[model samples]
Target: MISPHKTLLSRFYLIGVVATIVGILVVAILNLATPLEFIIAQLQTLRQGGEFLWIHVVAYRFAILCLLATFACVPFLVILRRVLTPISQCLSLKNRQQSLPPPLELKAKQRLINLPFIMAPLNILFWIFIPLCIFGGTFAIDKIDLAAAITFFIRSTMVGFVSSAIIFFGVESHARKVLIPLFFPKGELSLVERTAKLSILKRLRAFYRIGSLIPLAIIVLTLFVLYLQVNAETVSGKTYGQGVLNFSIVVFILSFLGSGILNRQISRSIADPINGMLDTMEEIKRGNYQTRVNVVSNDEVGVLGDATNRMIQSLAEKELLRDAFGRYVTPEIRDEIISGRIPLDGEFKDVTVLFADLKDFTPMTEANDPKQMVQILNDYFKEMSAAIKSKSGLILQFLGDEIYAVFGAPVSCKDHPSNAFFAALDMEKRLKDLNKRFVQQGRLPLSHGIGIHTGQVLAANIGSPDRLSYLLLGDAVNLASRLQTLTREMDARIIVSAETKQYLPESQTRNVLVRHPQPVQIKGQQTKVNIYLIK
Candidate 1:
C-alpha cells in the first residue's frame, strides 16, 4: 500500500496544477483574443511607452504577472503542507500502523475540508487584482474616467465568480476523493461544522447561478459597455465594436465548456451510488442476502444506503434460520410459524406425540468405531424421518440415537392419530432396510421401539422471545416417552396408549393389555396402564 505521505503530496500537486491551468486559460483566452488595438488602448491608458511596441510590452507584463502568481503560491503552499505533515509522519511510522489516533484524524479531516474554502478566496482575489491593475491603474493616472473603470470592474467581478467556482470544485474533489479517506477513513466529513458543507443542493444552486446565469449576465454587461463606448477609439482610431464582441464570445464559449465538465462530474457522483444500490438490490431479490451497499457520504443518498445495509443484515439472519430449520420441520409448518399464522402463546389441540429410541444402541456405540456409529445413526434417522414426514409429521429433534416428533398442531390433519400409528409402522419397515445394508457393510444391525399417544396438547411456539420452538406440552408427551421406556420390558417394537389406539383408522389388533408402568418388583408406586402392542 502507498503510505499516506505520498498520497497527500500527490493530491496537493494535482489540485494546484489543474486549478492554476484552468484559471489562467479562462482569463488569458478572453483577454488576449481582442480583435485589434485593445492591448494598445490599455497601454495608452497606463501611459506606457508602447504605442508601436504594445505586443512586446503586453507579453513581458503578462510573463512577470505569472512569475508573481507563482511567488504568491510559495508561502500559501508552505502553510497548507505544514497542516498535512503530522498525519503523514504518524501514518508512515513503520510496522504498527493500521490505525490512526482519533484526535489526529479529526484534526486532519478539518484541514482538508478547509482547503477548497481557503484556496478559493485567494484565487478570487487574484482575479479581482488583474482588473484593478489595468482599469484602476489607468483611472489613478487620470487616463480613463471613473465611469469606464467602474463598468469594467463590475464585469470582471462576475467573471471572477465563475472562475473561482471551477477552482473551488477542483480542490474539493481532491480533498473528498483522496486526502480525507487517507486521513479520516470513516465518519461523516460533511458534518464537521468547521466549514460550509458543499452539498448537492448547494452544488446545483452554484451551477445554476454561476455557470448559466453569470455567463448570460456577462454577455449583457458586455453589450451595455459597448453601447456606452460606441464611439470610443484606440491610438490607430479603430472602433471598440468588434473588440467587445470578441470578448463576449470568448466568455460564452469558456462558460459553456466549464458547465459541461462540472455537470458530468457531479452527475457521476450521484449516478454511480444509485446504480450500485440497484445492482445490490437485484442480488438480494435472487436470494443473495449477504450483499450490502457501500456508503461514501452523509447526504440523502448515503442515508438511503445505510438503511439498505441494515435491512439486508436482518434478512440475512432470517434466511440462515430458514435454511437450518428446513431440515427438521416441514416447509408448510415453518412458513406458518414465520408468517405469524400460528400463535406463539399456547393453544389446546388434539395431536399425537411420538418418541422412538434405539434399543441396545448404547452397547453398540461402545463396540463400534465412533465415526462408523455416527454414520449408522445418521442413516437410521434419515430413513425413519422420511417415513414420518411422508405422513405430514414434523420431526422436532434427533436426540442422540432417538427421534422425537409430533403431528397435527401447527398444521392440523384429520387423521393425525392414524398418521402417527402408520408412521410408526413405516419407521419399522425403513429400519429393517437400513439394518440389512448395515450388516452387508460389516456394521452392526439396528433396532428401535416407538411409543405414540394422542391427547389435547397445549401446542405453540415456546421459549424466550428471541428463540422459540413449536412444541407439544402436556401429560400426553410424557406418557408417550414413558411408553417407549416400557417397550424394553414388554419386548415390543411398537407400543401405543389406549387414547391413541382408539383414533387409529381401520384398527384391527385385539392386543390390548393392562400393565403397570413401573417394575412389578417396585410394588408401591405401580399404576395399571392400558396399552396395545403393534406387531
Candidate 2:
C-alpha cells in the first residue's frame, strides 16, 4: 500500500498541475478571442521584405514556449517536496519522535516557508521578462513597428503577471495548509523568528485583497489598450471592438477563478483556528486541563487562544490546590467546602468525635533530645493519621501530642461510629508497629489513650472573619477529650461512649468487647455520661 504522506505529496503537486492547466486554458481562450483581422494586419505590416507566414510561425512557437515554461514548475515542485520532506516526517504519527531532530526540523521548516517568498518574485520576473524578450526580440528582427512592439510587450507582461500571481497564491496557500502544519503542528509560527513579524492572517488578507483587484485592473488596462488600437491610424475600429469583447470575457473568467481561490484561503485562515479551539474546549470539558489552544496569529483568534491557555492554567492550579488542601482536611470535607454544600454558619449533626493523646508524653519529651522527640512525634502522627484516613475519619486538629478526629459532619457517613471504632483499633495496631521500630532503635516504646463519642454537635467554620477553622462545637467534643483524660484513671487504652456504641451496627457491636458501662460525670457536661472501656 502507498503511504499517506506520499499521497498527500502527490495531491499537492496535482493541485499545482490542475492550476497550471486552468491557467493555460484561460490564456488560450483570451488569445483566440483577440481580433484575428488585427493580428493579420500586424503580420501584413511586418510583411516588409519577409514572408507573410513568418509572424504566424513565430506566434505558434511563442505559444509552445509558454507551455513548456509553465510545465517547468514540475521540477520546482520536486525541489519543494525535498525541502518539506523532513517536516512531513515529523508530522507523521508513526515516525513522530524518530523524524528529523529539532535543529534539522527547524531548518527544514524555515526553508519550506521561505521557499514561496524567495521564489514568487523570481517566478513573476521570469514570466514577465521571458515572454517580453522572446516576442520583442522576434518582432524586432522582423522589423515590426515600434508601436506594435510596445503594445505586444505591455500585453504579454500583463498576462504573465496575472498568471504568475495565480501560481504564487496557489503555492503559498498550499504550503500554509499542508507544509506549515507539519513543521509547526501546534500552529506555533512564533518559533520561526523571521516570519513571526509577518502573520499568516495579514498575509492571507493582503493576498485576497490584492488578488481580487488584479483581474479588474487587467480588464481596465486591456480595455484601454483596445481603445488605443481602435484610434490607431492603421487599425479598424470594428475589429478592435471585437477584440475588446473577447478580452473582457477572458478577464471575467480569470476573475471568477481568482475569487474562488481567495474565498477558500480566507475561510481556512479563520475556520482552522476556530475548529481547533472548539475541539480543545471539548477536551477540557472532559476534565483534561492540560489542553491548550494553538495561537497561530496575532488577531482576535490569538487573543482567544491566550484566554483559553490562562483558563486551563487556572483550573490546573486550582486542582493542585484542592489536592494539597485535602491533606489538611479530608477529601470529602474539602469537596463539600468547594461545592458550597457545607454551611459556614453551622448546623448540628450527630457526628462521631474521637481524641487520642500520647500517654507519658511530657516525661518522654523531658528525657529525650528535642530533635529526637520531634522525630518520634512526627512518626507517631504520620502513622496514626494514615490509620484515621483509611477509615474515612477526618483529622480536625493536632494540639502537640494530641489528635482530634471526627467522622461524619461536613459529609455524612452512615457508619461513622463503627468507622471511628475501627480507626481507634487501627491506631492501636499502628502504635504497636511503631513501638517495635522504636524498641529496635533502642528507644522507649510509646503509648496513647483514645476516646470516641457519638452525639449532636455544630460542625462549621469558626473564628474571626479574617481567619477561620472548621470545628466541632458542643459538649460531645469536651466529653470525648475528658474521656481520653479518664483513660489514666480507668487503666484502659480505648474508651467508647455508650452513645457511640448505640450507633455502631449489630455486626460491629457483637465483635467489640466492652467492660461494664459506668455513669461518669464528664468535665463541662451538666449530666453524667455513660462510657465503656474497649478491649
Candidates in order have lDDT scores of 0.71, 0.72
Mind giving the per-residue lDDT tens digits that candidate 1 earns over 351-391? 99999999999998998789988888888888988898888
Winning model by lDDT: 2
Compared to the true structure, candidate 1 yields what TM-score? 0.72
TM-score for each predicted model, relative to the true structure: 0.72, 0.63
List pairs with backbone clashes in candidate 1. none
Best by TM-score: 1
